[model samples]
Target: MIFLKLSYISQSRLTGLFSLVILWTLSTNTWAQKIIRAPYIQLAKSNSVLIRYRTDQATLSEISISTDGKTFNPSIKSTNKVSEHTVAVSSLQANTKYYYRIHINDQVALGDSSYFFKTAPTVGSKDKISIFSVGDMAAGETQRKIYNAYVNRQKSNYTNLFITMGDNIYCGGSDGCWQEDFFNPYHAGPLLRQTALFPSTGNHDYDNQAFPYQQDDSNMAYYQNFTLPSQGELGGIPSNSEAYYSYDYGNVHLVVLDSYAWGKDNFRIFDQENNIQLNWLKEDLKATKQDWKIIYFHFPVYTKGTYDSDVSGEIIKLRDYLTRVFDEYGVDLVMSGHSHVYERSRPLREQYGLSSEFSPEKNWPFNSSGRYDGSDKSCAYVFQNVEPKKKGTTYVVNGCGGQTAAHRFNWPHPVMEYSLDKRGGSMAIDIEDNRLDAKFIDEEGEVLDQFTIFKEVNKITKKTINAYDPIELKASWPGPANSYVWSSGEKSQKINLRPLKTSTYTVTDTQKCLQDSFEITVNPPLGTTKWEELIHQPFESLEIYDLLGRTWKSIQKEGFIDQSVMDGLPTGQYILEYRLKGKSYTLKLIH
Candidate 1:
């Protein structure tokens, strides 16, 4: 270190020397550690996330991050010298947004306000989750447009995670293809920077120029580039292998299967009995208790797009085996991308036959459009554990993320309710509580098709009322049910009726796919019953009804209700009934 005498050094000279030193240090550090690949997020969880990037040469990597941009904490990690850098930051708050910047040799490599990530909501939290998924999205003009459409749709509200249904890189599926096709398009937007990736494998992703064009994971660029949560890292059974895995986000459980023969001695998803991949899938599905289970892979179980599911080799196996598993486990959605067209089937089960053999009466229980847009008979698919459990899986072939062309022969399978050909689009799924919305948004930001699914609806109820007494029944599903029809000829969710005698009333949604029944029994004028009135004794059960026999108030095991409980009641004649000592009592009360 050289120091000039304070008496001889002028202020101007001293300032100039300090500036020169700072500039030199920054320039050297930046030039030495040139970032080859921008930072991309991976394996994000409720409290942690992994960031991976590549540099020109081996250098120390550090991250400066903060919840609010006003302050930041730098975590100096990766002391080893390496071109590829993976930095993990932990102990973060759940479902929080954070801004981050990569520092190479203590110099800023990439950072901005837009460079931020939001953690996944707490594992089982009911927070609304938005997911974006695409298949066959090989980087090209159409791919970029689809990406832009998503970016435009989500200006500030970014997806919690993005999933690729395989075939991410086109052509040879080498490093060059990944750089130009995958990174080039993603780096131009906030998708990779802000969203964690969960990708499956496709046939083209295994293409390699090396000996044996279909190379193993060791030589496959697809495996080498991704850092998957393979070991129950994101809330699922430990898969150990990247070939296929499962993870949870909010209340959704997503399973990404490697349909292509690439893992464990090249065992494909369609292998015969005791297939390793299918075995793991069965175990995982059995273990997870999540509200929603979504399975995605490259081979579609039902499609009539570029490839016919009835004739395709792997799809046939998937249909024969996977449908049973999906139906057994009550899987909500099964997605795949290989046909280069869009096709969505009605909620179906056990239709593994050829297209000509499809029987809607047996295979598809919910045959509505499911658009929920007021179109003819269009209503959301409302599911429940009602008597005659109508648990079915909706199959989607979202293969038009990159390229779309003329559909194959018999483009729309008999099971499909909607089909779109020659349209490049991406799938956006929003899940909150029991309601899920899925949309196929075209490259022009137009929602070509959409549908809704509701879970845990009660299809049956029972009540006893006096003759000519009215009772109110409410629909269990959310949203306005005005388009529905009830046995009373009412077209709304809540309806009131006074049945003259014991009878059952039924209500059906607009699509006629959902139905609810109420069994109301008329009690033969309980006013004439002979029982000791509970004047001062606390009753075990009590119900108050107006002259119309409509239940105004009801309670069980509440001990007693004071006059204040009737404050809201109108001044009219009322009937109070109570059950005590295993006996019933009725009194005419005038309010």
Candidate 2:
């Protein structure tokens, strides 16, 4: 009986082991079936959002992206599987919430209820926002480790938007390499939690496509991963096929182009016979009019190291043809990377090199402005006229995001102003109505460099323009030493004071310089005071004055007594000092 029991136990153990093996085999098959893996995923940069991811296989049985955890529906047309089986999610609503999932054919592979994205707003949207961008990335355990620092910096800061200036991964750079090099590093970071990543293609991006060489591959990974805006003026390729695209943010418009496309068939960027990209660029530039315009690409036109100067074939061709266009319109700045260094050019053009107004003897016509303390910062020979001209666009190359290559500091561009090649860094562009400021920040979040691009409002050209006779006020009081006080209680940028009340306020400080008194008068709000009730000389108009004998302006039945004005004025000291009751009644105006 004991021997029979032992046999039964042994049989049970065999069955259990067999069941475990079957379970393991099924799990392994499921993992292999997934075409995409290590998805270093992100949304787009500007107003649009592009989703990027890498796959584990060359060709998948089937692949699709679906909203949240929903099943893929072919009729929706939202899913796209591109070259190398990579995918991009595009054409989403700006400043909104979205959920998504990935699928391999009909089998749902990765489903997370929390996978979400928010698109940026179009121009004039008036949305306060946050964004991020980095450049010069590569594959390595070191890059992987630094990536965590990047993710942490992003999570705890004001970077809601993300942009990558190519070189996202550095495996041998295939779809498989991107999985290992790019996505695997930060696949689980907060930056991925909720952010959009706008990526520009770099030289390393086209490493292994069917094209003859790296330059010829056309960045299949970049195109496959990000779904870019295709419908607007950025034409040349299919709407979705064109690597170049534009998106608006508040009052800013950003145009992203594939620099490698212009990088010459035989390593020559400027071929008159093959002007395909140049033509497309002209059309694209003529199409947009946001308050500020910024362009991003891989090869920089101005740099202090590596491929410096526009003479580097591609840079020269692009600069010669495109710089004029950017100036014709109001492009605020242009940004590029791939130098493994950081450099900034002064606002430049054919005429102005570096200094705007300061004219040096050598550069003859174009001289730096010598006006501001004679420091020679003006790139005057380029754009400055007797009157202020629309400023030239400044170009910046912030390529040191990550790379094994080092920089040699010999700058070549005549307009180049600042250059640095050190540890990795990033740039932050702060945009507002009046100005767009670019700040270069290092990995440690220390500000390495700073520059401001002041937006110049172009002259209004119209058949008939509405004009206002700027409210003018005149005051003449005692000598130069006399202290002069005016009403409205605020200091203005202009030296001459102008008041709309037609009344002037003047107070003399005997301890100050000379002051010449003029026909000064103060009037109360039309409704607040009865002008006819006040008695005065027949032809001489009556006037009112405050405690310091300054005219308090009043017009159109309203006076400057809002909280702002009242806050500074003394409450018990002010008076309705009008000659109504035969004499001026010193009435206290409450705060």
Candidate 3:
């Protein structure tokens, strides 16, 4: 009986050992399915967000999101059978913060406090919006410094979105390069995970080939990695393709174009007349009811950087083709990055010609200082929003996010008010009410340049005056002016003008550095003596008077009145007043 019992105990122990081996194997397998790339957030709308990640082996993806950071009751799962996973979570609140945890095959991967995102404000909301833009950002310490500069500068300030002005990945935008150059530096790090990215395609991002050529290239990774707002998913007209699209954030309408794809000769999307992208842009701009209109692309319309828009065929073509559309649609700002330098133009208009042909009067109608520096009391470029025609659009080339290249030609373009090629930097823009404030913050955390554009609600008044009337012209402004100069040689706030001939009087507020003009025309008095017969319509009442305020004649007559009617009248200058049904006309006539 003892031997039998010992045998039974040994069998039981063997069974226990076998069970431990099975548990160990299961644990090892779960550990082997490691998360190779950390999860990142994208496509952040007011009510939804897309979470993407990758693992070492094929595994299902799951995510749990919570607003309070604790009770993650809402869970999302992806059914795609692959290592790379993307799961979209929807039905969220706008302008709210959310905490999330990533899971691989139902196993927790990331459940830390750092994994959180703030949803964009509801569309058309009056909330103040801020955005950070960088271009050609490659993975390295330099890129980190630029990002850190932005973070340190805006520590207390939260950004609504982050924009990449193309060349997102360096040395061919492959999957590996995207991971190394983009994900690790910007996403895996703390700066970009919270904000959604809106990207434009640079030459490198388009694989150095045109869009048509890239359609068949299986190696093109940009389309594979990014889930952009095509099909009018966010707002504006549907672009139908990811190559070019637009979105609305708060009061701003942002249009992103594929400059490299459309700028090339063989693969150009615009033919100076019509194309899908051009037509889409036209319709999109026409449909946007937003207060501020901003457009961004890869190639610059005007720049004096390494790539000259004046000489390059592609750049010239794009500039000549795009500016007319921008002007027609009243675009407020044009942002681009391809020159690898920081350059900003003054409030410019009608600059579609060659660089040599740029005229201050024609291209730069608003040539005042756009810098917010207190040297000039005018801190912002004010545009009256009443007119369909835009006053001007400020073109900014903020390409120094990761690298800086010196200007090969003249350092400054004719329309440029500020140009800096010294160091790399990023751009931060804040939109509040009708004012937009932009600053170029360099890697050193210094604001290299700053400007503000204010959309004024009030309209400028235009007036016409008769000569010899001595009309008092008053400058209608709310603030005190240091000096005021009228084109008619008057240097006072109010000027009495009695011009003998037609003239245009331009008033310049030297303190505000703004100019406004009005025109006046002179007319001679009616001559004495009857030389011509009077012609009148049927049932019209006519009356005649002299310069001495003496009535000559009054009659309700029809048809032509011959010279016989004035035969008995005294030879003197006279005024003829004609009256019709609910209408009256005054004419200077000779008696």
Least lDDT summed over 10 consecutive residues: which range in candidate 3? 1-10
Tens digits of lDDT, candidate 1, 1-591: 111110111111121111121100112233366788888887788877777777777666677787886576755444455566665656677788888887877777788888888888888887888899899886688998998998899778769878987888777878878888888789899988889988888888887745333323556778777777677878788777776889999899999887766446455667685677788889999999999999998888778888987787767886888888988888999889988988898888878767888898988777578898878777788777763456689999888889787788876888999899999999999888778899999999999889899887646899998765558987665445486688889998788776757888988776665677899998875444212333455788888787666788888874765665566788777777778899876676666
TM-score of each: 0.75, 0.59, 0.70
For 192-231, candidate 2 gives per-residue lDDT tens digits of 5456555677777776665544332335655544544454
* Shift of residue 300 alpha carbon in model 3, Å: 0.6
For TM-score, candidate 1 versus 3, the one ahead is 1
Model 2, residue 222: displacement in angstroms?
A: 3.1
Query: What are the clashing pairs of model 1?
Result: 469-548, 469-549
Model 3's number of clashes is 0
Would you give me the overall lDDT of model 3? 0.71
- Candidate 2 off by > 4 Å: 1-116, 141-160, 210-219, 233-240, 262-269, 351-390, 412-414, 456-524, 527-591
- Superposed Cα deviation of residue 132, candidate 1 (Å): 0.5
Which consecutive 10 residues in model 1 have the weakest lDDT in total? 2-11
Model 3 spans with C-alpha error above 4 angstroms: 1-31, 208-212, 215-218, 262-266, 270-272, 387-390, 458-591
Q: Report the CA-based lDDT of candidate 2 relative to the real structure.
A: 0.48
For candidate 2, the per-residue lDDT at 441 reads 66
* Alpha-carbon RMSD, candidate 2: 15.6
What lDDT tens digits, residue by residue, belong to model 3 across residues 490-573? 777677755545666777655444566675655664343343744433336777766554567888765345665566787666
